[model samples]
Each structure stands twice: as C-alpha cells, then as structure tokens.
Target: MTVKKILGAAAGALGLMWVVRAAWGIPSAIGASMSAIQPYASGAVSYRDRHFHNTEPGSQIVAGSARSLLYSALTRRNAGHPRGVIPLQTPVVPTEAADLAVTWYGHASALIEVDGYRILADPVWSDRVSPSAIIGPTRMHPVPSPLSDLPPVDAVIISHDHYDHLDKATIRSLVAAQTAPFLVPIGIGAHLRHWGVPEHRIVELDWGGSVSLAALGRTREGTDLVLTCTEARHFSGRGLVRNTTLWASWSIVGATRRAYFGGDTGYTKAFAEAGTALGPFDLTLLPIGAYDERWADVHMNPEEAVRAHADLCVGDPGHGLLVPIHWATFNLAFHGWSEPVHRMVEAARAAGTAVAVPVPGQRVDPNGLSPRDSWWEDVG
Candidate 1:
C-alpha cells in the first residue's frame, strides 16, 4: 500500500478506538442519576434543597485562583505517585473468619472480621476509580487480589457513593461472587439497583440507622452482628451534580467486638458522637490521605485521622488498633506518596495510639498486633 493510504487507515483506526473506548461502560459507571436517586434520598433529614447536606457545612474546595490551580494540575501530574514499585502481598484468607482482624486490599477496600463474621468494606477491585476506564486516576499499585479470591462474606459495607469507595464493576462482580448483602448509606442502593444488583442484596440506611446480621439471615452461633450507618463529613457524586446521595462512615458491632470503618471524610465532631453512641471500637480503619488545604473539609490528613481514631476510642488514644486506609493504592491528591503514613505514625506515637501500617493485602489481627514497620519507605 502507498504511504498516504497507510497513514489514512491508521488514523481511521485510532478514531474508532477512541470512540469505542469512550462509549464503553461510561454511562453505566456513572450510576443512578439525580431523579432516579431522589426517591431514596429525599426522606432523610440531611436532604435539603434537592441535595444532601453535611451537618456542619463543609466545602469541597476552598476559594483559590483558577489559573494557579490549573497550572499546578498541569505541572504536577506525578506529584502523588510513588518513585518505585509498590509492594503487594497475597491476602491470607482463613477458612473461617477470625474474632477480630482486617485485610487491607488497597485504597479504601478492606475485609473486616469481627466476632467470627466476615464483612467486606468498600471493595473496589477495578483498575481505575473513575467513570471512564480510559481516563482518570489509575491505581498506583495493582489490586492485591482479584474479586474471585475473596472468601464468602457475611455482609458488604459501603460508606458512600464516590467512585473510589463505591465502584460499579466491583459491585457487579461481588453480586456474582458472593451472596453478602450490601449495607450502604441512603440512596446508594439506587446506584446498586441501576447496576442490576438485586433488591434483596441492597440495604440502605440513613445516619444512625442500623441492621443486624441475624435479621439479614446470617447468624453465627446465634450471635447477631450489627452494622450501623454513621455520619461522615464528605460529599458524593458520580457525575457533575453532587450530593444527590448521602455519604457516611460505618460502625460494625458484633457480639463481643466493635470496629469502625471511616470510609472517607474530613475531621468532624461526629467522630466523638459516634464514639459515645456506638464505639469504644476495638479496631478502627480510618482515612489518612487525599487531604489538601483546598479541600480540607472533606479529606483528613494523618494527624486528623489520629484524632478521629482517638475520638472513636472516646478520647482514649491507646485503646484500639488503628489501621490507616485511603492511601498507598491510588494517586488522588497532591501530597507525597508516603506522607500520610509517616505523619500518622508520628501522631500515633505522640498520642500513645496503637497503629498498624500494613502493606497492600496484608492482614492484621488486633489480638496479635505486630510492631510498625517502614514498608512504604522503599516504595515511596
């Protein structure tokens, strides 16, 4: 073929690829729209002005010059990524759930075991946490394990509807791989329904609402496991319009043990309130990344995570095993890759808080907690 014809054919192929990529999975990935989600969200007390509002007014982004922000975005594309390969561990899933343990599956995804019941929290096994697979913040490290590798869970807990925490692809996989019901904040069930998740598998709850494992027909030795939808200081959206659904933290209560999963949030007094109402948690998995001065109201830094842990422990910092989540998996902010864990370790040390910094996919049993190791330093 002539060079001109070859070039023309190549260009045509490129155009077709771009179109196919953009159209594939984008619409479904955006989840339920505002009108579709309203019926589920409107009755909640936090719903107002056609959107869900935080108890304490919070800003997603603080005022700043657009030009400078744009410049920084363009210039510091690699600011949040690590300098070396992020190490991964093959998850050690036991034949039966432990009394109290957690498996960090990167980002906000974790498997929590309490009182012999296995609960999966925010399991996003997708490579990209965005509506479009061709674009957006890709995973810094590959998912430690595939969805198929996970054992049958008693329940699945989702904190919010953000892409990172509530993924369409992962939810679809979970529906097929496991029979666990998804207990989520109000209106997130709409998204699940939109994605073809059966109604029986979706449980929606407002802040302070809860459901028991026995009620869901999953019981262990006749012991009940309670999952509560607690408050969080964050916003939720899958597209341009925001907060059509509620965002939240989760309180996992078993017969003899309690744990808190702070999916993603900034500092909030609600932590103290949760501690008083349903805490004195034995294990706390909290966010300690994706924080910036511009959006300080929504994302907590390491110090704030430590404070949140303390608050959940009812001001007793030395109470529980604090496991840092929301970092080391994806690049979603402007801070250094390992900055959050470094600061968290320092804060925990000063506050006398017990912390476990696990590599992606590593499991931690609060009963037999190990000393902290600087596993992330070489990678970052």
Candidate 2:
C-alpha cells in the first residue's frame, strides 16, 4: 500500500476508536453549557425530540445513504491557504469601543465587543475539529490570534455541541487561559462539565432564555451584558444520539448595541423572528458558508443571509452593516475556498445590502468601517 493510504487508514481507525469512546460514554454530547439544567427561556422548547439526532440516522450522516462522506469526498476541498490574504495597511483592531466590534478568528470563532464587554463565541484555536487528533476536518489555516493574545473577555458563548464548534482541547485551553464564564444553550453544559469546566463558570440557558452578566468594564454605570439563547433550525450531536441536547444562535445585547451570533444553522423563519423580538440589531453576524442544495433548510446561502438581515429590521437592510462569517477559517465543506465569500459579496450587492468582508483575523467595526479589497478571489 502507498505510504499515504496506510497512514490514512491507521489514523481513521484510531479516530473511530476515540469517537466510539466519546459516544459510548456520553451517548449524546448535547445539552446545557453549565453543569445544571435550566428551563426553556421562551416558555417552551422550539425543537422536537427526535431519535435520528441521537444515533446514526439510518446508518449514515445523510440518512439512508453515505451522502455526507460521498459529497465531502467529491468536493475539491482544501484548507485555509495562504493565497488570499489582504495585507494590512495600518493593522486595525475591530474592537473600537469596549463594545460594538468583532474579530473573526476563523470559521465561527469570533471575539465580539458590545456596549463595553468582550464576548468570545465558538473560539476554536485547536489545530483540528475532530474527536481524534489525526482525523476529521483539520483547520486550513492557523488561528489568526493565539489563545493567549485574547483580551480579558467577560463571557464565552458556545452555540452547540458539534465537534467542529464544540472542540475539547480548545475548550480546555480557553478554560485555562480566559477567566470568562461559559454561556451555553440547554444540555451543552453537560459536555462542558464532563470536560472539567468549573460549575460556577457555567451558565446554562434554553432558547429565548436570557442571563445578565454585570460589572463588565462598567461603561453604562448600571447595566450588565445580557445573553439570550435563540432558536436555529439545525440538528446537533457528537455521537450516536443527536439533538438530545440543543443547538442555538445567541443575541448579545450590551449596554447600548446588540448583535447576533449565528452559530451553525440552516435557513429558517427564526432569523426574522429573532430580529423582530431582539433586533433591529446594530450588526448581524450571519453564516454564508458550508451550504449545499441538499441541506438548504439547515444553512443559509449568501442570498438568504441578506434577506434575513432585511427581515430583521425596519430600515434599509444595510442600516446595520452585515458582516459575513462561518467561512474562510477552515475547510469544513467543499466549494472553492473563497467561493462562499465571493458569492456572498455578489449576493449582498444584488440585494443592495451592505457587507464588510474582512480578511480572516482582521477585526471590523461595522459602524465606522474601512474599505476591504476582495482577497479570496485567488483561491480556486
């Protein structure tokens, strides 16, 4: 056998073994972010309890078929390449105020500033997003900012328990490095506790639920940073059992401005609902990556993301600058490395929506924004 093939087989075997262990013990690694349970915030849960999310649905990820593996292999997938970086002229940090800024570290990992508090969302700095160190979708590029370089954040929000979003080593590293509390959706806290995160450091919530974190940098004198768990149309699971816990997006309302963190999701009416109830957001961080025709309902395409922003507010869809995320950091799904952003930019233009597409690792203040050249066009 070829050396690469032998190594691939060995690595896959070991990874499968490790995944088996994680699945065997926990069965389903979805639940609250804290160590305890909390009632649903919107009075009732939005999703139905399904058996498919908890186990291998019909023996495959795509249900009754190996479509996930097949499509994943068919796509000319590549990791974050060095070809498409836009050089920094002045090297700006997006965090203008203590609040109202965002640094897209890669994929969905971002350090968001609002009102006067710093919140890290889905901070994955690890080399890979898989159960085994050797397998799964590895990061295409290095994390733009090292974990230590992260400023003192007030809270870290985890949207779900998927391995890509909810990495173990990354979580442990964040727990050791940042003295921030973990705000997660219902049942996700089980995995966090199992991974050794302290109980006091965990605050669990369900969809439409909100929690207030006070005294963070004290900008508005008497206000606290509020985090609200919002619904997303998607599925979750780390093992055989899926959706046993929960998946979500978050509404981070600071002292003055508010923003939405689009964790992995599909297209649903929830975005408009969230915007109506919790928006006209100052900024909306929505996903415009990893979408395919087969799963249109789960992930929003670039065009849909723009429409979502419009549905979120009363003014111009661009009233609140839209920053595109969930792409450019890692090679999760296949399409060209820059295709997601390129298409998104086109869609944004067609929709007459304003978008700030920053180079991975660069921060942007959607309010007082600067011009950014298209950097991803080179990757094919």
Candidate 3:
C-alpha cells in the first residue's frame, strides 16, 4: 500500500475509536476528579480505612453474580420499562413558599418548600444516569423544567456521589444557573470543584453536622433555616470504587415546619435516632423504587420505606405526609415498572400512613394533600 493510504487509514481508525468511546461512557477514573477529598472525607466520624462506613452492622451492598445480573436483564425485559408514555407535568414555581410543600421531578429529584425557603434535593436532570449519554438508565419522561428555569433556591442538597444522584452535567448547569450553595455529603465537593463550581458555594457536611442558611437571609417570620446532615444506610461512589464519600439523609428545619429528605437508603436503626434528634417532621420524602432482594441491604423496598417513614416520624408514620420519590423516571430494578408505587400505596394504606404519590413535576402541599390517585396505573 502507498504511504499516503496507510496514513489516511490510521487517521480514520483513530477517529472511529473516538466516536465509539464518546458513545460509550468516559471511564469514571478518567472523567471524575479525586483531589482534595481526603480532608473532607476523613473529617467525618464514620470515615475509616479510606471510606465512609454505614452505621448498620453486618450490612453489605452485594453486587450479586454477573451471570445472575445478565439473566435478570435479559429475562425481565418487559418488566423494566413503562407500559405507556408516562405523563409529564410542567412544574409550577409557587409565588411564595408554602408551610411545607414538595415538587417531585422524578427519581429522587424534588424541591422542598418550608418556612418561605426552597431546597432542591438530588437534582439529576440528565437523560441518562451515567457518565455517558448513550448508555445507562435513561429517563422515562422528560425533565419537568429545564435547569435554567428553576427558581432561585436557598440550597441544593446532594445525598451521595452515585451517577443517578449526582450527574456532572446537571451539576455544571446548576452551578451556572443558581447562586445557592451545594450542601453535599463529605468528599462530594471534589466533584463539584471539578465541575467548576465555586469553592464558596460548596458546603460539605458529615453525619450529625449542621449548617444554617442565614446567608440567604431570614424568612418572612424572621427565622433562620438550618440543614442537618443525618445518617442513611447506603453506599456511595460514581465509579468502580465505592464508599469514598459519605451518603446521608438531610433534615431541613424551618421555623414552624421541618422536612426530611431520605436521599436513598435501606431500612436502618438510624431512622429512629434521626426522629428522636429531628422528629415530627411536617413532610418526609423517601425512596420507594429500584429495590431488589439482592440489594435489600442498600436499598429499601416500598414496605420498608413506609416503616422508615414511621421511624423518622417518631413511631407515627401518619404524623407527617409521606411523599414517595425515586421511582417512575428510570428503570433501575427487576420489578415491573409500576410495582413500587402499587406496593407503596398498598402498604401505606395498610399501615395507615398518610402517603401521597405525586405525578412527575406535580407540586403538592402537605397540609391539604389530596387523596391518593394511581396516575401511574395506566402508564405502567
């Protein structure tokens, strides 16, 4: 072959390889930032052996076997996706914060309104919950509102560093669009910094730590809003490694009302402790999806979520409104698409827990919550 032909062929091969890599995900080790994580990670009491440990003894996040995983993936094909197009609603930003309101945007992303303050939790708006756009669990519905359209929030809380909970693209967009500080679990600031978020806007906290949002100014009734980092029985990581950063539930304490954001957790004794320490919450947002028997140690099923809510509400699951999150937007489990909500509603009814299953992007007021309507019944 001619020298020119050889050179052209080599160039073509390299270009094709680049396209393939982009279609797949960029390796987490190459794409994610790891610097400046040790100090923040080690500052937490739970940090040891270069990782953050869950308080639940003998609990382990089992990955199961590769053969089993593949079998489930192939055999449960029809069970993973919705039966029809999931209804999507346009999110409405209230003129003023309600006493305790929540706007669920699907799959663990929700906005909490308490004491005239707004807090956005686990705001993952990307199409896929992975490092790549072409792979991973894609969203079942479009984002209710664009990130640029999000109203000014007092704080953005990140529960963990998993790809589903923390998307690099969404973080970058939020950093550019919102002035609120990113309140994250320990070591998560490294990802924020790598995404070009300002250092001043990053607030890293360990379990039992608290931060007051006085910088956002007092509420209408002259009360300072506070957020406490609490315990969660879960693991965290975005790449091949695990538990490099802390995972947590958050307590948003307002003047007359409080809300509990249970990011993503399995059932644990810590929920009762959290209730004792930060109890009688006006509202509780808990995960009720993506759970399986194999990962029960790390993810709570619907019934466990109801029990967790009860534990967080001081033994009265009905004490506060329970609005289920972390479902309907993505297919990340082996159960049928609508199974989580069905199970959650059934369990809540049985336990007499006041539960509300809000459609994607619907804003709900806990004080005057409407009756449970199975909107997802027809969709999946």
Q: Which predicted model would earn the best TM-score?
A: 1
Alpha-carbon shift of residue 156 in model 3 (angstroms):
0.4
The stretch of ten residues in a row with the least summed lDDT in candidate 1 is: 63-72
Clashes (candidate 3): 0
Give the residue spans of candidate 1 off by over 4 A. 1-13
Segments in model 3 whose C-alpha atoms lie over 4 Å from true places: 1-32, 58-66, 215-221, 369-371
> Please, what are the lDDT tens digits per residue for candidate 2 over residues 164-213?
78887778888898888899877777778777899888887877888888
Error of 1 at 192 (Å): 0.7
Pairwise TM-score winner, candidates 1 and 3: 1
Candidate 2 has its poorest 10 consecutive residues by lDDT at: 51-60
- Compose the digit string of candidate 3's lDDT tens values, residues 166-273: 888888888888888999988998878777889999998889989999864434556788999999999987766778888999999987898999999988898999
Q: What is candidate 3's TM-score against the reference?
A: 0.92
Better of 1 and 3 by lDDT: 1
The TM-score obtained by model 2 is 0.81
lDDT of each: 0.91, 0.71, 0.85
Please give the lDDT score at residue 242 for candidate 2: 53
Please give the ranking of all candidate structures by lDDT, highest first, separated by commas.
1, 3, 2
